[model samples]
Structures are given as structure tokens and as C-alpha cells.
Target: MIKSYFIQNKSKDLKSFKAMLMWIIIFTFTTILSFSQETPYYQLPKNRKQNHEMIVMPNLDAFTITYFLSASAGIRKPFVQQNGISPSAASFEAPANGFWEIALGQNRNDNWIYEFGITKSNNRLKTSFLELSRTPLVFTNEIEQYYAPFRIKKKILTLDKVSRNAFLNIGLGVSYLIKSNNKPIEEGKITFGQRPIPEPRDYTSLNFRIASSNQPIAFELLTEVRGKVSERLEISVFGKAFFRNNKYLNNQFSFTYVDGSSKEFGNYEKPISILFGLQAKFNSPKYYQYKSRVE
Candidate 1:
């Protein structure tokens, strides 16, 4: 009876030991899984403003240069006969004005840019008188002008896959006429050379220069298509418009012949003009990296 009792007790102890071993294995596995699923104690904040260890840098964006040509729609004028001899109709033609500009630009925000720049421009005019029985008479005028413009541009479209952008800009400008020359053309030969001289006594006088109005205020508008050419360079083609409520850049001119006949040409006003141009913009890599960091 003692031997049988000892066997039963030994079996009970063995089963208890097996059950205890199973419980210990399950507990160890569960503890390991909980530890593996835990997050790190320290993490970085996703918001830039909330990050205390982040550095802030200045954002200086780009420098740009542009060259443009103007297109003017010529207007016709009439001849005034003093000696009872009315000549045939006269017509006025003004060629395109060429302009060059250099500007510095700053990114005002994600979709806007601001630019301030100076432009150099020159205007030329050609006038012809068509008489019934006489050779046509021609007159010419030339002027060099300068202006400063402040503009803000908005991005209308952005194509990141192609690295291209389109923008529209509007701004205000002031123009100054520095030099001018006007002369009559005889037998298709230009009479005088356009050169700098001492300030003429009548430089700003009425009817002496092509423009009667000087230093006029201008409103400017521009549209651009820009593409990235390299890490530091971008290329663009643009169209621009200017609205100046002055006599500047007018196709109109009045001249008197040696035979006492007077003629007036054009519509006597040039309120708006158009220009098309090419631009090259340079960027700094250091500033470009700042764009990536903030984004």
C-alpha cells in the first residue's frame, strides 16, 4: 500500500511540473511580444515650428535677365495743304522697340514672386508722304529711354514632373527719355547720325523730339513660361504689356516741307504697347536647399 501511494504522488508532482513549465513559456512569449511592439521613448516632431532643434535660414531666391522686342500697330495720318494744293494721303510706320532688363527676384510665398528691375529701350519711327505726281517724302525719329519697374508675379500653373511653371505679373513703372533725334529723309538717305551731344536748348521743347511727354508713369503686365535648365539656371519666354497715358512711344510726327506744306501723322497717342522676350534666371544652390528642408 505504501509503494502504490508513493507512485500516485510522484505522478501528481510530474503533471504539476509540466503545467508550471507551460505557463512560464506562455508568459515569456507574451512579454517578448509586448516589448517588440513598444514605440521609442524619444521622437522628432513633424511640424517645423514645434521642433526646437531645427535651424532657420534666410531664403534668397534668384537673379534674372531679360531681352524683349516690341510690336506696334501703325496708324495713318492726313496732310494739310496751305497753298490750295492737297497732296495724297500720308502714312506713318513705327518699328518695334527693343528692350533689355536685369532684375532681382524674391519668392514671396509658395505661389508668388516679387521683382524690381530696370529696363533700357529705344524707339524708332518712319513716316512717308504719298503725293499724286511727286516722289514720296520720308521722315524719321529715334529716342533712347530708361525705366524702373516693380512687379509681383503669381504662379498660374506648376508641372513638377516636367520642371516647368507659368506665371502672370503686374506692376508699376516710371520711364525717362534721355536722348532723342528727329530729321527729314531726303531721297531715301538718312540725314544725321544719332549721337550724344550737349543738352540741346530745345531738348525738352514742344515738337522738337519725338515724345512731347517725358517721365511718364507706366502700368506693366507680363506672362511667362519658365523651365529649369540646370541646378543653377532657368530659361523662360514671356510676353509683356505696358500702358502709359502719355505721348511717349507714339508713332505720330508733324513736319513742314520747305515748300510751305505741313503734314501730321499717326493717331497722336500711344496708350498701350506689347513686348515678347526671353529670360535667364540664376539660382543659388544653398537657398534652393532651404526649399527642400521646409517642405
Candidate 2:
């Protein structure tokens, strides 16, 4: 199907077709070279097969750990799935992140990968105080921009043994925000990071309606596929999701107003919030070593 599609558009998409053709040739050549040497390469020694046959995943004759960096584009909604009232300041529409990965395992089959990532947003909601008087004065809302999403991930499913052409991997991760800006909120109560909380870190406050804690940890999951374009380069496609633990990450800023009776807001939090994103990855070989299990 794909071959015919490309063939049909060969004339119309000449440039694109040419580019695609070039990559195909490069990948084919690289695959041949990866295992071709005067003495032969990437072939398992007969003696070592017995020891590795019991393993669930495929093994490589010689392989090394892979390192990568990726850029992510996605969304981060409130911890609560829905709210009777909107957020006081948070209107997170687009979320972005940068991640680093360290992978260990057989290059062609499965591997254990460790990951670290950080996310943040520049969008801020601004509302102002209003007064109905002879002359109306505008009090623009000054909401702070929130960020600092740190995550750790582990890849459980990987199809690297087939990487001479393409590969796939799936992973799970988590994010924690328990330190730095931490506080509770009530309908009419104020939390940390809001005004008077001081400059620099005031943006991390809980001064919004239906707001949760500064540290409502979230769970993350991802799937990625890489296509070899050349011996040293591969292109990737990926999808990821983040689900907040509402049971532990509830809404703390879900409040209205407390004339004077309401002072202290409870410690309880408010619901499930989900965030997701998609990304493209560009990978290149960092280094390669010739190793043999048996001499």
C-alpha cells in the first residue's frame, strides 16, 4: 500500500519522493554494513546460544547502551476532571517538555531505559478587581505562571532487535511536586504563592478557584517508534499521556468567600486530571563498541 502511494505521487511529489528515496537507500546500505566485515559481524557464537536461550528477550552479539534527548508537545489540564467553577488563574492550554533517556539492554530486542524530563508553561490568566463608581477603574488580574514538572520513566517494552530498519518502545513514568511551593486553599481562603507571599515565587501560590496542591503528583505513559533513515540517524514518532491521582491530588482552591467565619482551609485535596502529548524524535549513534561473548 505504501509503496503504491509513493509510486503514484512520484511525479507530483518529486522533491519529497526524492528525499524519501535517498533515505531508503541510506538505511539499506547501513543495515548491510552493520553486519558485514571481512570476518563477519553481529552473529551469535554457537557456544553462547545455549546460555542465552533461556532468556525471554533476544540478545545481541555486541551492543552498547543508547542515550537520547527529546522535545515534547502536549496539554496539561487541571487535576480535577471537571469543576463547577473555572480556575482563578490557571488556563493551561499547551504544555511542552524536554527529556533525556539512558537505555541499557540488547540493541535488537528489549532494554531497560531510565528517563528524566521537565515541563512548564508560559500562559497566565489575568483578572482584575472592578468597582461600579462614577469613574470606572480597571484592576487587571495578575496571575503567576506555574511550572516545574519533573518526571522519571522506565521502558518495559522495546523492539530494538529489529532496529536495522525500525524499532518500538513503550514506557511508564511519574511526576512529583511535593516540595518548594506547597499550600492549601479554601473557597475564600488564600494559599501560598499568591500576593504577599513574596516576589520571585509568588507565582506558585494557590489563589485560584478549584485549584489543587503545588505537588499533585501525576502518572505518565508513552509509546514511541523509530525509523532508520541512515546508519547513524533515525526518526521517531511518539504519543504520551499523564493521569493525575485525584484521590491524592484534589482541588484545594475550590472555594467562594467566607465573610469572616472561614479562616483555615482543610488539608484535603480534590480529582483526576489527565494530560497528553505527541512528539517526534531524532536519534543518532553516540558510539559503538565491538564486543563478543565468547572468544
The TM-score leader among the candidates is 1
Cα RMSD of all models vs. native, in order, equals 13.0, 20.2
Q: Against the true structure, whose lDDT is highest?
A: 1
Candidate 2 steric clashes: 13
**lDDT (Cα, tens digit) per residue for candidate 1, span 1-295:** 9999999999999999999999999999999887766522222222333212222332322332232222222222211112222234666565675678777776543256666666777665555657522677555555566666667767776655333343444443444433334333222222322236523321111122333346446676777766656535667677767776655444444334433455444533365677777777775532222233333
Worst lDDT run of 10 residues, candidate 1, spans 72-81
Q: Give lDDT for model 1.
A: 0.51
Q: What is the TM-score of each candidate against the true structure?
A: 0.52, 0.42
Q: What is the C-alpha lDDT of each candidate?
A: 0.51, 0.42
lDDT of 1 at 171: 40
Question: Residue 137: error of model 2 in Å?
Answer: 19
Across 1-295, the per-residue lDDT of candidate 2 in tens digits comes to: 9998888888678888789999999999988776575223323343234323323223435444445555656554432232333323232221222332322222332245454545543221222212222343222211222333443334444455543355666777666543333234324433432445344422232233333334446666777675556544445566666554442333323323222222112222223334455544344443334444455
Clashing pairs in 1: none
